[model samples]
Target: MSGLDQRRVLVTGASGTFGRQLCAAFTAAGARVVGVDRQPGSIDGVPVLGCDLTDPATVPPVVAAAVDRLGGLDLLVNNAGVGGPAPAELPPDEVVRQQLEVNLLAAWRTTAAALPALEAARGRVVFVASRMALLPLPLAAAYGVSKRALVAYADALRHEVGTHVGVSVVYPSMVASPIHDSTADAGLSLEGVSRPEPVQGVVAAILRAATARRAPRDVATTRRGRLELAFARHAPTLADRLVRRTVATRIAAGDLDAAPLAAGMLRRHRDATG
Candidate 1:
C-alpha cells in the first residue's frame, strides 16, 4: 500500500470526465487500473467494463471481474453520480428518493461489493462528494440531500472499517467537466468555475491515504475547504445560515441557474472562507 505501483485500482463512472482522469492518473502512478461505466470501451489502454451500477445485481459481478483481472483491489473510487433538473415543483420525497437511489444507494452497493476485497488488502475507498454535502443550498434539494447521505455513509463506513481499511471522502467545488453539459441541459451552468483539481491530485491523495497506515477521513483542496470542515464540526447552524445567505445573494444576482446554482454558491462560500 506504500505505493500504487502494481496495486489494483477500480474506478466507477470511468467514461465521465473525473473518472476518465482518475483512471489515467492511477495508471500513470503504476497501478493496474480497471474502469467501469455504463458504456463499452477503454481509456488510455485501461479496460472499461460496461455495467449499470444502479442495478444491485451488476455491482458484485463488476467487482469480482475487477478482482479477477487485477488479482485484488487496493483502491475503489466511487465516482459515479447523477444529477439533473427534477421539476422544481416536484414532491420533495420523490425527488430525494431518486437522488438517493443514484447518488447514494449506488455508491453504497458498489462499496458493499468491494468491501471484502478492500478489507482483505486493507485498502482504501474514495468518495467524490460535493460541497453541497456540507452546506445546503436552495434549488438543489435532491442533489443536496443525496450528497448529505453520502457524507453520512462515508463517515459510518470509516468507523466500520476502523483501523482496517482507509476511507476518504473528497468534496470538490465546481469543476469544468461534462457533468456540466448534462446538468446544463437541466438549467445548470458551470460559469466562474474553479479549475478542476488535476486528476493526479485526487489519485495521489487516494494512493497516499490508502497505502499509508492511517488515513484522514476527509481531503479538500484549500484551507477554506478545510475551514468548512471545521465549521461543520463546530457550528452547523451558523454554517446553514451562511449558506442560505450566499444562495440568496446568488439568486439576487441572477448569476446562479436552477440546476447547479445552489452547489455553486456553496462552493463560492467555501472558497471565500477558505
Candidate 2:
C-alpha cells in the first residue's frame, strides 16, 4: 500500500493554486484531507475551514476542527503566504510585516497548534517556502527573508521533533498560477523568473517530501531552482554577478526605481563579498 493511503492530512492555503493541487493529490491517494484558508473555498467536498493565519486565536480552533474531522492529523502543510515584490530599497513596511507574519509566524502558530495531533499520529509537517529563499530575487527582499526564516524554522523544528514527526520544506520556482498575479499587477518586474514549473510537478515533489521515511533537509522543484541553490552555496560571486546584472538591466529599462536605490543594493553585495 502507498504510504499516503488512509493518511489524515491538514493543508493550509487550500484555496491557493499549489494548495488546491496538494489537497486533490492527497485525497486521490486515499488520505482524509482537511484544508484551511482565509478565503471561503472547498475542494472535492474536502472540508476547508476559513481562518486568518495571522490571527493566533483563530488558529487553535481551526486546527481543532481539522483534527476532529480527520479523526486525527497525519500531515500538516503550511502553504499560506503573500508575496510583496517591489524595489528592495523601499519596501512598504506594512506589506513586509504582513509577509513575515503570514509566511513565517503563521507557519509557527499552525504547526504548534497541530504538533500534538501530528506527534500522536507520527505524521509529517511541510512548509511551502519559495525559490527566493535560496537565492534572493531582485526587488523581492521581503518575500525572500520571510521564506528564508520559514526554512530556518523548519530545520530547527525537524531536529527537535524528528523522532516523532517528519519535517520538510519545498522551494519551488515560478509556477503558472495566480499567486504571481498580484505581484505583477503591483508593477514588480519578473525578468529574473525562469520558465514556470508545471503545477503538477511541484505538487508531486511536495508529497514526496511530506511522506518520505526521512524527510530531506530541503526540496526544490525545478532545474533553475537547483542550479541557483548550488550557485548560492559554492559560487556566491557568480550568483551576485548574475543578480546584479539583472538589477542593472531592470534599472536601465526603468522597471525598477531610481539609480541610487539600485546602487545601494549593489554596494551591499560588493561589501559583503569584499
Candidate 3:
C-alpha cells in the first residue's frame, strides 16, 4: 500500500539492525527486495548476497547480480555504515579510515554500480546518513565526517543523475544497535546527548522518501532530529555553542573520563575552565 507494490528494491548492509527492519518493511509493503552484505544469507525470507562493499572490486558484480535477480532495480538503499570514537585532535587513524571507507566510499561504489539499472528503471537511491552528519558531536569525528561526506556525495550524484534517477538522504538521530558498540566500549556513549529512537522510525522515513511523489532531498527520522538539523543548517554558530556546552558539561561530570580517545579533549577543557 506504499506505492511499492511489485517494485524491485536492492539494499546494502542487509544484515545490519536497520537493514533487516528496512528490508522486512519493504517486503511487507509488497516490494521485491534483495540485499547485499559481507555475509550472505537470508533475512525475513529476503535473499541476501555477500559482498564486501569496501572492496571496489566486489561491488559492481554483486550489484549487477542482485539487479539481475530482482529483474530490474527500482530502489537502492545505502544502509551500510560503521561507527567508533575518534577525536578530532588526533591525526586520522584506522577508525577514521574505516568509517570513511564504509560510510562514504562504499555507498558511493554501490550507487555507482547500481546507477545503470536504476537509471534504466528510473529508480531511487536512499542513503541512510545520521544526525551527526549535520550536528557533529565531539569524540566521534569519524562518524560525523564520513556521514557528512556521504551527504555531499548524494548531493553531487543527484545533480548528475537527477534527470533519470531519484536521490534522497535519511538522517536517523540514534538507534540502539551494534553500530554504537565501539563507541560505548570506549566509554563515549551518547546517552545524555542523544535519545535513542526506535529503528522502525528510520525504516518508515526511508520508505516514505522512496514512495514520495518527488524524492525528498533529505529526511529526518524523528522530530528532534529535524530540529537539530534545522539549527545546524540555519544557525550554525549557535549549534556549535550548544554542542560545546554539552561537551563541557559531560566533561565536568566525568562522563568521558574513561574514554582514552577523549582524554586530550577533557584535559584541554578542564585546563581552560580552571
Candidate 4:
C-alpha cells in the first residue's frame, strides 16, 4: 500500500496549475484531498473551498471547517501565494503589503490553524517556496522577500514542531506555467532565461518532499537553481553581482524596464564584492 494511501490532505490554491496537479496527484496516490482557492473552480473531482488566503478572518474558519469535513488533517499544503516579476522600482506600499500578506502571512496563518490537527495526526507540512527564497532576483524584490520569509518561517516551525510534524519546503526555480503567461501578457520577455523545467517535475518534487521518510529541510528542482542557491548562501557578494548582471543585461535588451534601480543595485553588488 502506498504511504499516502488514505492520507488526508488540505491543499491551498487548488485552482492554480500546481494546485490542480497537486490535488490530482494526491488523489491518485489514494489521498483524500481538499482544496482551498479563490474562484468558481473545478478540478476533475477534488472538492474545493473558496477562501482568500489574504483574509485573516477567513482562513481559520475555512481551515477549521475543511478539517471538520475531512474528519482530521494529515497534511497541510501551504501553496497559496502571489507575486510576480516586479519592476526594479519600489512598488506602492499597498502592492508590497498585498504580496506580503498573501505569499508569507497567509502561509503562516494557515499553518497555525492546521497545527492542532497536524500534531494529532503526525501530519506533514509542505511549503511551496520559490527558488527566489535563496537566489533573490533583481526585479522581483517583493517576491524574493516573501519567499525567503516563508522558508524562514518553515525552518522555525520545523524546530518548534518537527518531532511530531514533518516539515519540508520545496524551492523549485523556473517552471513553465500560468506565471509565464501572465508575465508575457504584461509584455515582459523571459527570453534567454534558462528554460523552465516541466510542470510534471515540479509536482513530482513536491510529492516526494511530502512523503519522504524524514522530510527534507530544503528541496531544489534545478541544478542551476541549486548552484545559484549555494552561491547566494555561501558567496552572497558574487551571487548578488551575477544576479545584477543578468538584470542589467535584460534591462539593456529592453526585455525589462528597470534600468534606474537595476543599475544602482548592480553597482552596490560590485562594490560589495570588491
Candidate 5:
C-alpha cells in the first residue's frame, strides 16, 4: 500500500467517469490495472471485464478472473455505485432496492470475493463512498442509506481484517456524472443544494488512500467535504438544523413542486411551517 508502482489493482465500475480517470492515474503511476464494469471495454489501456456486480452469483467468478488476470491482487477499489432519489417519508420501493443492491451489497460481495487474494498479499481495499454517507440530503434517502451502510461495512471489515488487509473509505462530495441522471429525472436535481466537484479530485483522494503509509480510516476529497464531515460528526443537531433549512428554502422556492415523488413531504412541510 505504500506505492502504486507494480501493484496489481482491480477496480469496479471501470467504465465510469471516476473509474476511467482512476485507471489512467494508476497506469501512469506504473500499476497493473484491470476494471470491472457492466460494459466490457478498455479504458486508458486498462481491460474491463463485463459483470453485473449486483448479481451475487457472478461477483466471485468475476473477481477471480480479475485476480488471475493480474497474477495477484494488491489493491481492490470498490468504485461501482448507483444513485437515485427516494423520499424518507415513502415506503421502500424499487429505487431503494436498486441503490442498496448496487451501492452497498455490490461492494460487500466484491470485497468478500477479493479478500483471500488481498489478505494473502497483505494488500488494501478502498471503498468509494460519498459525502451523503456523512451529511445526507432530503429526498435522496436511498443513496444516503446505501452509502452509510457501505461505510458501516467498511468499518466492520476493518475490524475483522485489520491485521492483514488494510481497509479505507473515501468520501467524495457530489461529482457530476450519469449517477445523478436518475435523480435529475426524478425532479430532485441537486443544482444548488450540492456543489458538483471535479472527478479528478476524488480519484486523487482514492489514490492517496491506496498509497498512504497506513490506510487512513476515512478520507474526504475536498476541503469543504472534510469540514462538512466534521460538522456532521461533531454537531449532528446543528447539522440537522442546517439541512432542514436548506430543504425548507428549496421547498419554499417550489423546487420540489414538480417532483410527484416528493408530494407527501412537500405537503407536510408546507402545512407545518406555513
Candidate 6:
C-alpha cells in the first residue's frame, strides 16, 4: 500500500471541484484513475463515466465498467454527496430523504458493488464525510443525519474488512465547493462557509489513506477538524453547542447568504491570531 504506481483507483463524483482535483492528484501520484460522475467529463486525462448514483440499477453497472476498464480497483473514493437546502416550505421528511439518497445510500451501493475488487486488491475505501457528520447543525438536519449514517457505515465496513482491506473516513470542515451554491439555491446564505482547502489537499489525504500500511477508521486533516472529531467522540453535546452558536452568529450577522463568508471569517481569525 505504499506506492501508487500503476494502481487502479475509482473516484466517484469526478466532476465535482474536489472530485476533479482528487482524480488529478491520484493520476499525478501514478495511479490509473477512473472518474465517475453524473456528467461526462475528463479529468487529468482520465476517463469520466456518467452514472446516476441514486439509481440502484445505474450505480452497479458503472462500478463494473470502471473495474473492467481499470482491470481492477485498488482504491475507492466515495466523494459524491448532496446537501439539499429544502425550501422553507418543504416537509422535514422529504428534505431528509433527499440527503439520505445522495449521501448515504449512494455511498453504500458503490461500496457494495466494488467489494470484490477491493477485497482482491486488499485496497482501501475512503468515505468523504463532513464536520457536520461529527457536529450537527439546525437547518442541515438531513445532511447531518446522512453524514452520521455514512460515518457509521464506514466504521462497520472497516470491521467487516478487517486487516485485509483498509477503510478510512475523512471529516472535512466547510470546504469551498459547489455545496454552497446548492445551499444558496435552496435559499440559505453562504456566509460563514469555510473556504475550501485546495482540492489537492483532500486528494493528498485520500492518497495517503489509500497507500498507508496501517489505516485508521477515521482521519481529520485539520486542527479544527480533529477537534470536531474529538468533540463528537467524547462530548457530543459540546460539539453540538459550538456548531449551533457558530451558525446562529452567522444568521444574526446577515452574512449567511454571502458566498465564502465562512472561509473569510476563518482566514481572518487565523491571520489575526497568528
TM-score of each: 0.83, 0.89, 0.98, 0.88, 0.98, 0.86
Give the range of the ten consecutive residues with the poorest summed lDDT in model 2: 254-263
- Higher-TM-score candidate of 1 and 6: 6
Give per-residue CA lDDT, model 1, range 26-72, as digits (tens). Answer: 88878899998998689989999989888998889988998898999
Clashes of each: 1, 0, 0, 0, 0, 10
lDDT per residue as tens, model 6, 71-174: 99898999998885642223676667878998999999999999999999888889999877867655566788899999999989888886678889887777
Better of 2 and 6 by lDDT: 2
Query: Tens digits of per-residue lDDT for model 5 on 118-141?
Result: 999999999999999988998899
Report lDDT per candidate.
0.76, 0.82, 0.93, 0.81, 0.93, 0.79
lDDT of 3 by residue, 119-221 (tens): 9999899999999999999989999999999999999999999999999999998899999999999999999988899999999999999999989999998
Q: Which ten residues in a row have the lowest lDDT in candidate 4?
A: 256-265
lDDT of 2 at 197: 77
Local lDDT at 109 for model 1? 96
lDDT, model 3, position 224: 86
List, residue by residue over 1-274, the lDDT tens digit for candidate 2. 1388888998999998888888999989888898999966678888889999999999999899889988998889998888855556784678789889999999999999999999998888989998778778766788899999999999899889989988888988777677677567656646454456788888988888877777777787876777878888799889888877776666556664443435566566557657
Candidate 2 positional error at 38, Å: 1.1
Q: Which parts of model 2 are misplaced by more than 4 Å?
A: 257-274
Predicted structure 6, TM vs. truth: 0.86
Sliding window of 10 residues with minimal summed lDDT for model 3 = 1-10
What does candidate 4's lDDT look like per residue over 1-274, in tens digits?
A: 1278988999998988799999999999999999999874568888898898888899999899889989999999888877655655665466568778988999999999999999999889999998878877655677789999999999999999999998999887776666556446545545655457777777888898888888888887767767877887899999878766776576556664444434555565557757
Over 4 Å off, model 6: 86-90, 93-95, 193-196, 254-274
Q: Over 4 Å off in model 5, which ranges?
A: none
